[model samples]
Target chain A: MTNSTSIPIKLQDRSATEEFVQKFDTFLFDCDGVLWLGSHLLPLVVETLEYLKSLGKQLLFVTNNSTKSRSQYVKKFAGFGIEVTEDQIFTSGYASALYVRDFLKLTPGQDRVWIFGENGIKEELNIMGFDTSGGNDPRLDEPFDVATSPFLKDGLDDQVKCVIAGLDTKINYHRLAITLQYLRKPEVHFVATNIDSTFPQKGLILPGAGSAINSLSYASDRTPEACGKPNLNMLNAIVKAKGLDRSKCCMVGDRLNTDIKFGETGGLGGTLLVLTGIETEERALDNTHGNPSPKYYTSKLGNLYEFTH
Target chain B: MTNSTSIPIKLQDRSATEEFVQKFDTFLFDCDGVLWLGSHLLPLVVETLEYLKSLGKQLLFVTNNSTKSRSQYVKKFAGFGIEVTEDQIFTSGYASALYVRDFLKLTPGQDRVWIFGENGIKEELNIMGFDTSGGNDPRLDEPFDVATSPFLKDGLDDQVKCVIAGLDTKINYHRLAITLQYLRKPEVHFVATNIDSTFPQKGLILPGAGSAINSLSYASDRTPEACGKPNLNMLNAIVKAKGLDRSKCCMVGDRLNTDIKFGETGGLGGTLLVLTGIETEERALDNTHGNPSPKYYTSKLGNLYEFTH
Candidate 1:
């Protein structure tokens, strides 16, 4: 409800940067614009991360992107010469899996999920020992008749207890039809990885997980419990996994709506906004977006390199 | 706002049926469930049509189905031994073309359309002398990367002035992306054939034209000007083309939301509800749907045969 665009404390002085770094024992970083954009790593991210590691701060790479698995993220990190373990990366896919297994308390063997995503979700749910169907299946690659297809008659497996929806390139009527079928059941759980309507790639914004999930929600007249940034579930999953005190943790990202709002609502120690992605400093100061204001602002992640020096 | 369940006048008596027949000179009929369901003709439909024609009533088949052209519907009518001309059939596809050509007044060769449907929409638009792209094009049948694809860079023709979306069996992310791209422009028009959330086939309900439109609308944050049943655009198109007096025409269908509401909002003489489709007799009488109550109710089209006899 508050619409005041209060200017955040700019991290300009070396002492100010050092003082800011001393506050948080855990650092949660959003991947895309903060660390890298498309295939290229941003400047100073490697050094800043290394500095945080030298300070013995726990580091976690959190991304709303549900396209890749934790190991894939680790590989991506390694590709950038940043040594990261699978345990340090938290993606929407991994968060969704954790939400289903731990928060929802659905037994892996007894419960099953119907996924509307690609390999990322499948791999994570597989790691969690959960049985899932309808993800990246070539059988569902082609369009199916909703009326006459034998699939509609009795093809849906009734054991599906939850529906995990994300960014699916192969999204079609058949996948949505089955997802709707499960969602219609009162007992079935509906979980969305994230609802970011569009994501930027190479300066062009394209439809994201929220767009697909929006379609399913509109058709089914049901809203999913999202397990991504800004929902607090993803942050809570990390907290529960690492046993970290929420008061000593901070979230750092470029987008205010997803990143800063996530930290604010998720009860993190503080939020830092970097102007390396979608939002401009002028727009961030406008406050009409209704996003939570970050505690600190920097031109980019590279500014934090001064603290390490 | 009116939720009172008012019992419709049941046309059981011969005099009542005769009075119902005398009330309207032109008869607008909804196809599926009223005359036929899928490939099978319903009971007494052929005889009822013959009886209505014998009474010198002008018969028009108005269907919300957007998958088939008027000629295709005519052929469907022929398949059932019921003779109908292309002029006699008013499909959502035909209605959409007319809306684009006459209502929206987008010029041919000057202003183009980006369609999110099948051959039905394409053919009708061609008939209306409008240039169109993206409908059933095998090139767009599969999902395309909206951000990285060269098409997104500048592949879209700037002359596209309108977006027409309907029931496309081969709908994918690419078509929707193109549609959204056009919709983002303030000058571009957005039109939907119908907003029927679901249609019944073989006793099972399947996602309809609204599902696709809903997705695009959600992504684009734009609501389309729907041109199908229940919106009254299709009915108005028919009335304008035929120059028929509104008081002399009546709409007949099984569904209350689409058919009966179309009549009520479209300024028809009356709406007659038949109990062979999506809405049950109990549901029609319940009035909780907030749909216009039909003036007359019958078990099926067969009930009108009593007056002819």
Candidate 2:
């Protein structure tokens, strides 16, 4: 898998699509723009997935959204009339928890992690048997007093060895203060779910997990070891868990930065960019300087049905 | 004055003290650490100010704390047995409001400015006759719903031509969301009170105004036009209002980054770095590549009294 500066092979015709599909046994799909947009599915996506499955290709759904647990994601897939096990889904939440448990090698019961995220990450961490605090804690939502607040005193928990940050709607000053305090200790680990600055919400790009985590990063002068798409941690976790051959896998998604770049950096067999999401075909063709270019490009993921038969 | 890479002149003996004090007529003093720490006044500061006053030297109090209004600062000065008028106190809150009203030239009654700070900024902007919203608003403190929130829709007001961000205890997602929304429009002005990442609180350095503003800056991909110490807007505001000669004014502060840098960048007569605050003498003397060096160094602001006779 040599890096190339040349334009991606456009999979428009049946012959090009057939050649591209035959190269990989497993397909990693990005959920949002590739699978569906909000509550609505894209054109011919159901047929495309069904056809691909009929061809005996393994399917996996990967998303940087750390807002939902794997169980919740499976339920969402069911709502779309698609049956996917929890194992088939890889979210930033699961990846972050796995990274803390396996990579950082923190003792699940003894080591506590302070979370700056929602229930998704909390649930994942809990399932992995890690003691966690500071996420949506009712105490954190309490009023913050600058002068008399005990938080201004010796408020840090010395036992907390890691801080996991993700998309948190309940973000407040106290949580950020504690996170900063923990990060001040040189030995404490800082893990971020993903670094996506903005995610689509109601047709507008709203601040995402990266934005939430970056607030603390800026204040604390510490950077988190991110474990999501565009980073190889999520893919590495999947590859390690499933014992799949990395050379036989392909990443297919709508965004170039997260999906295509994820494949490129993670050493996946190939990357296919579908122009149904955030980026345009013109941008895919343009020389993006240092940005990773995909191996194949198509108008939409639905176009894969051409070779599925 | 010519910029020199040499170490700052240490005013340890009588001659250096007299020579340095004779150089400037108007003295701008940073309140915290120089005059007081938290709530305790530093030794000999009262006598030093009295002696400087007896010598016909003009005095002014400058602080980056946007948590209190000018009247509040005056009250604090009075509590310390210091006689100072509201005009003698210049806070980041006042500087920010003045920047919006005078420098930006936004119509006070007609145009609206959204605030992301506390009562200090709100009161200052109100005093300057500008109608503003979103600072410690009760509505903002309400729980944020990511999925169904109307903030993702047309949440921006067209009349909101400027956004002033400072320290807000009630800082929430909604305020940041609206701030980002307004910043997306190129015509909307983004003003930050100060970029101080941390300030001393109870012997610990806690997150400051810069931390709050930087969070939004990172998310929105926009840089704010900061109007605090080191940026020169506050000093410039005072200079414009008082019609004082810049060569006759000197800035005395404990922190080199805020006070000394503020004086240097604002083109004041001199900068005096005191050892009573955030930085140590070793750090002040270190060749900090791009950091502005002070013209003179003293153990504390009280040491200025050596030249009173």
Candidate 3:
């Protein structure tokens, strides 16, 4: 649903919320801001999600955060008194793995993929039957001395023909140096999980995956094929895998540039914006820059709880 | 000198070389590809410098490599059997220091400058008499864990109003995280030594200072005021500091983008390109992309040795 109005209609009343909810059979929810901020769960997230489930709506948690695997996310949901299966979650890491396997056409067991990220990327890629290296390696954590680096001394690994970069909490110069060596080759395919610059965490903005991805891009002078929100590839993959009707899917996210754009680009039934994330309500309504505006908006995801009846 | 020709005039014969040498009273040299590759001097560099010195030409070694200080560069020169004083060298680190002191108007000793580079940047900033922090800090070398980071616990230091980023061989996420906190504040000034993507080292293209600088820039969503080559500020600083006539000085470098554009933008007597580094004879003469073309070209810097006689 493309709304030309500068201001998104707020789903304040029960009637409007109810009418909006009935329009979609499946809901794609962004996890970081809509469900939780940092570690603590947002207010009424559990109630709202439960209410949506009660309405027989399929809920899939779509997150750009590549730090955690599907199993880890399932555990996180369980910790928060919410039950979410691995099938109900889709991460950028998983998307990257899918892109690598299906698009790049690399034989899983034969080709080694070099990862410049955390365990999430490695775990997801391994699940896809690919041999992975360089993720969370203790050797990469060491201080980078050009002359002493074993990566330079040993030369580039001929086996590793693809590099997938995601958010790495333990990012260091040594790891980047090794990744650069792989990326320097023209034949090595470069992929990034997401290009989100910064994410909201405990009222502070921290460097996101884009920072790591951009560092390599700038050094290698090559742009990586990004497999994240606003790219449409991830949404297409989800729809294809789950066999969800695009006409009955509503995307609920907190970011206009990524989540909202992703929904609009993929031609979802509707897009809902929540104010609990990176975008401000004022900036969202401002029609100055031709930004993707959400069809409906609410203060929190919990606002839909009352309309569940 | 601006050359209208698509191809730069080659300094081949003795008459052309002699004519070129007679035009400039001073020579500004780029270190890496011109004088040396890595840890070793290029062919006939000793003889080249000696010949220029014999002609009573003022020689200033200007480099974008921010890994070493002026004194360190002097040692490198000495190791190569070339006698050069500290004032005769201008590093991007030193240029950043000067920019911080003069342009940023940061008070010496009173104001604190946060460094995101190697000892070269720290040493230069300290020489300018500014209180410096976070360069080669053992604390920042630790693996970055958001929950346990001391920076997150302590919060951003209010005194650090300026962040000068350069090349750091040991760049880590913790260091970048701290830098991002400072940069998040709009009041803080962001300065970069240079933004050269990669540099050739021992037949391998390695991540340069731009990689580290870009990581912070991408994370913070801010553009840093660069003080290195192609910016013209460094050249202006050099000209003013030395009280030399711009018309009498010629720039000699290997890269066309940074080194050649720098001289061209500064309106030097001439900008000479050497094929010992990044640029090639083919790309230099392409003239399709509106790139800053060199006034003259030679196979290597050592070719100038014959002209100096």
Candidate 4:
């Protein structure tokens, strides 16, 4: 939890990242359920960021919640007492768009799509230069070529090119039903922004975007293409922006599944599972069988204060 | 699917009990995941039974894959299926002599115990029938006041009740670890008749008697009690003598979960799933939904009939 960028290292408590200054340059952080849950940031996170910044460390606010656009996150940071540019924020929704652009080539004119994700994910798709404008409400629009889950109904006939999934309102079952219908078609591809089921909170675990994905996968019986953490889509994007070697980047977060699993699942480096956030000591003890046991399981960011002071 | 007993009309094809009746009249069904996966039955099972019994309701069989007692299910099955003898083969593994006589106040005598589960799951402080012939296998033959998880690895401090949950390999994990050590306690009871997982197909689900009751529920969580299924300890010894109102008796099954669910998961029905041998169709459909729906959804004996007239 040491803010490696700003906090001066004392003769005592320096993190491995701090000790080996050049080994890791970029720090990727999970936003929701880590930095903040719902609408507020956790206590001490701001200090942690400030300390890291004081050290001149590079930081990226990465998120899997596709509900908001980059502008929204910038606004969120202001509310959290932190000033950040849209360029400083990254989201799985952004990654999903990049993935579609690079891998999913278009043939100039293609079938139209009806999207149900928030404006962020939708805008990302639109940015990719795909012909996707068909109005937000699915019922009023012309029949779309594809519809994503987290919104659409299930069991519809083939016409949908893909079924995309992202965070959605709990009241979005009718939309899910529609998505299920479109996804039932053999031609539709199923995509999920990420798959971290339990989002960490203050000493408790809450459902995350993955809960929405779980429903989509169950109803459609299709495995989703993950575009977020631990997936190449996001990693490639970071590489394009920073032009840094993979070894020079590290991920830190509060939960084990998303933050820690991202390191292993994506073949990245050193993961830190901070106890101050989501996972409990007992849960950490249970996952001992896997390799890379959370590079470091620190109780809290305050613990690093000892190493620094 | 069909109720062979009294009002022999088929309501619907949902339970696999008709198939169990076709095979074993005196059946012991395990509940959970068997009779109703999540919450509904395997499809088209009712007619299968009514169809079979229309020919003639034969010997009826139904058992559970649970550690609870039969009388427990007798109370559960007031409406879900056909009405029958309290002794009509409904069963579980928690039917120790004391659980039967002393706990139920049905018998007058001392209690002896044989365990395959943990001590907490199978114990009775009684003077009449305590199995004193102890030697080794702290689970089977040893002098321990009480049994505990293997993690204890020492001696038991609690008064001996009974040894149970036989030989669970999963006990090697933390769950079984605690239960196995519990067996070493002195002055306890030891008893077991059967151990079956809540699920039998895949996923290494928690089991019933044998080692599962002790290791899974007791060691891992639920805290199990062991009793022989189809034993005099439960309905096993009593069902045959109690002329089953087979016409009023209906059995349900999803084979692995639903059939097992109803049969054993503390449901109120005489149920079991069969591959034509144990489960119903709807349960299979739900379990395998969005993927391959169940074959022989008919749940009729035809599933097994490679060659039928």
Tens-digit lDDT track for model 1 on A92-189?
A: 99999988998889998778888999889989999888898888877677567655554466756778889999998777877777677777787889
Where model 1 places Cα greater than 4 Å from the true spot, the runs are: A1-5, A9-19, A146-150, A153-155, A306-309, B1-5, B11-16, B146-150, B306-309
Worst 10 residues of 1 chain A by lDDT: A1-10
Looking at model 4, residue B67 earns an lDDT score of: 32
The value of fnat for model 3 is: 0.75
Q: What is the C-alpha lDDT of each candidate?
A: 0.83, 0.83, 0.88, 0.48
Q: Candidate 3, which segments miss by more than 4 Å at Cα?
A: A4-6, A306-309, B4-6, B306-309
Interface RMSD of candidate 3, in Å, is 1.3
Tell me the native contact fraction for each prediction: 0.38, 0.38, 0.75, 0.00
Docking class of 2: medium
Candidate 4: stretches off by over 4 Å: A1-23, A106-120, A127-158, A169-178, A215-221, A264-270, A280-291, A296-309, B1-309
Clashing residue pairs, candidate 3? B1-B269
Considering chain A alone, report the TM-score of candidate 2 relative to the true chain A: 0.92
- List DockQ, one per candidate, in order: 0.49, 0.50, 0.72, 0.03
lDDT of 3 by residue, A131-209 (tens): 9989888877777766877766787788898999999888887898889989988999999999999888877778889
What is the C-alpha lDDT profile of model 1 across B217-255, one tens digit per residue?
776778999998988778877998888888888889988
Mark the 10 consecutive residues where model 3 chain B has the least summed lDDT.
Answer: B1-10
How accurately is candidate 3 docked according to DockQ? Answer: 0.72
- Better model by TM-score: candidate 1 vs candidate 2: 1
